[model samples]
Target: MTETSTGGKGAPATRRLSAFLYRHDRLRLAGLLTPPILWLVVLYIGSLGVMLVSSLWGVDSFTGSLVKKVSWSNYHTLFTEPVYRTVALRTLGIAISVTLIDLVLALPLAFFISKVVQGRRWRYALLIMVTMPLWASYLVKGYAWRIMFDKGGVIDWMFAPLGLHGPGLGLTATVVALAYLWLPYMVLPIYAGLERLPESLLEASADLGASPLRTLRSVVFPLLVPSVVAGSIFTFSLTLGDYIMVKIVGGTTQMFANIVYDNVGVAGNLPFAAAAAVFPIVVILGYLLAVRRSGALENL
Candidate 1:
């Protein structure tokens, strides 16, 4: 009798708590979101805050120890140094090249898969092929490109008949490899946007006596701009932060990412590395702001 009474009492309390939560929608939402909010605050924002704080500190030149004092010396060096400026420009150029190359390649392929392909099965197959490279390891893809660009490799063999040579490992190779790697990122968004586009609009354009080129230019291209910008965000930001690809196929080329890596690993200067790492973050934030201003983020 005593055990039964205690069990009955606990059941009512549990039911009451459940009923309270069910009645309070905002409270229930807060309970559900609290864990993820805590994780974002503690892990992501906390780490960035630590890095920013460390960037403000300096390393003692003589002892190679960290100085606890806060100073702007690291940022000062990055702004004032010519080599840093050169690496920043080179990194920006490479990123832009990769984004443009991917954009040009993705547009037609996405159009064909989403619009021209006759059957659902064929479209799915092409999409699978486009995304298959992503399943492979990043290092594997980089090294594969390295082999293709090697002297007397597949590229050279193919071009031998044309009396040409492979690009070898350099900026050209870096741009090509980066483009190939990020092509799927560019293709999928444009493909989705094309899929969502109404065929009635195209039919109306044709009915209005617009040529194929005109329909594509005035109708398809304008509608697709938001998706293009969305995909460019991925490609551009990725290329900006890439270091391993350049190391594999960049020959002697040094990107901004390479500067950050070298500072941390080779130079053992954490403060400076943290500062150098801010360059890409700033650039990406600026890009996001520009995209936001253009209203492309709404599509995303």
Candidate 2:
């Protein structure tokens, strides 16, 4: 018989690699996760750490330049300065108002689209309508609202008959624009949660002689809390960090972000800007921790 060339003892490279991966699931998982993990740790967390360290440094009063001296001067200025305190509080209030407005507006519409709408086509159409605004430029949307809030703009024309006036470029206008911009963010998550709810649970509530309002109050609202919280997190954090909208719509009012921007650009105080930036980071982190304890993130 012939001496067969059995391709030696070693397996092909592809077969070897496949066998190795199959034998080591953890290795496969680590390979899959390495890119995202590196990005998050290096880009996001590393930048935050650098900012935090910079915030701890001091600034030169005469030259208006950053001083590398490690001290608590920046944070001390933030805490001791009355204007910083006022801006921080004002920003928090506006953020909360935007979140509440988005919640109230989104809840009813999300429920209607997810439950009340009959067919798949109609449901998708309504979803597209809800998401349509997101396709436009953020600056364009802000400027459009600015025009609408102008003295002789559409808002004034619409409510002129009622002897009312638009809020104009101020805190109220800022809140309105923020709420409008973030409404879709709130609606989509709530809609998804509502859609995933079981029809039988609602029917059981009805069969048990529960009123529609009672069914909603008892069966639906509790289940929706996590989704609402998730949406609020986005609306709250976005409003907190936004400077452009405030610049466009907030005439004289200054948010925390405005303070940071002014320090960086106008004042040429990098250390102070970094310090001012820390307040929003702390506030958001605390809010996230609170929501985490309430099991919101788990549900998400």
Candidate 3:
């Protein structure tokens, strides 16, 4: 090994790395993170704070300003009103269902990509196609969902000849559409985790007289908990936040996101809209925190 010019011989690499970080790379890395940090602060955190404040207040028409009473009336209305309760439950249900179905579809597909399949270029191409829906306008995507679930739409036509009569424009269609849209999000995270699993470990499982199913149950699934949790979080949170797709494909009586939109836009009750937004955040955050605390996140 080569010695340094200094009396200390082994510090050359460390000194070079420290210099590079301080002089060149550190600032660049910080710059890269700044925009996203700004976005989180200005857009996400700022909006959430404003909404929280609004949720605490009451709207009065004659006063034409929010009453700073900081009461639970808004939340109380959410629980006491049957319509609100039903819609909220429906929203939560749809989010959970979407997350689960996407997980079911993604796990096998990711396993295939990681274990059964080769030629990653083609596989990645197909993965990109699945996420292409995200590139389109969210409104257009919702409208596309509307087309698929319309009475004379392709979904109905496909099942019509079989005498199974497709019931379009409702909760079921909304769930299916959300699942279809979020499935890619689930797949990407799972694929990442699956791809990173060691090949030799799988071989070892096979050597232990474990069938493919058993190996998956004991070995693969355990290692994939983190990926599953992450993917489920994305799917659930996205569906919970989505109103446009549900509104386009669903009936007048729908979920909480729709209810929030109605209150803000149609009902002109900003405080209630603010209150409605809290349900999804509270539920989603609570679930994610639970998962993280339960040792599931560490596996990732």
What lDDT does the true structure give each of the candidates? 0.93, 0.89, 0.85
lDDT digits (tens) for residues 46-119 of candidate 3: 99999999898898868656787788899999889998878778888888888888988998888776677668
Where does model 2 exceed 4 Å of error?
Answer: 1-16, 292-300
Q: Count of backbone clashes for each model?
A: 0, 0, 0
Q: Which stretches of model 3 miss by more than 4 angstroms?
A: 1-38
Rank by TM-score, highest first.
2, 1, 3
lDDT of 1 by residue, 115-166 (tens): 9999999999999999999999999999999999989889899889999998
Ten-residue segment with the worst summed lDDT in candidate 2? 1-10
Please give the lDDT score at residue 175 for candidate 2. Answer: 96
Query: Model 2, range 9-78, lDDT digits (tens) per residue?
Result: 3447668898999999999999999999999999999998999899888778888666888999788878
Q: Residue 256 of model 3: what lDDT?
A: 76
Quote each prediction's TM-score. Answer: 0.90, 0.91, 0.84
Residue 126 of model 3: what lDDT?
73
Winner on lDDT (1 vs 3)? 1
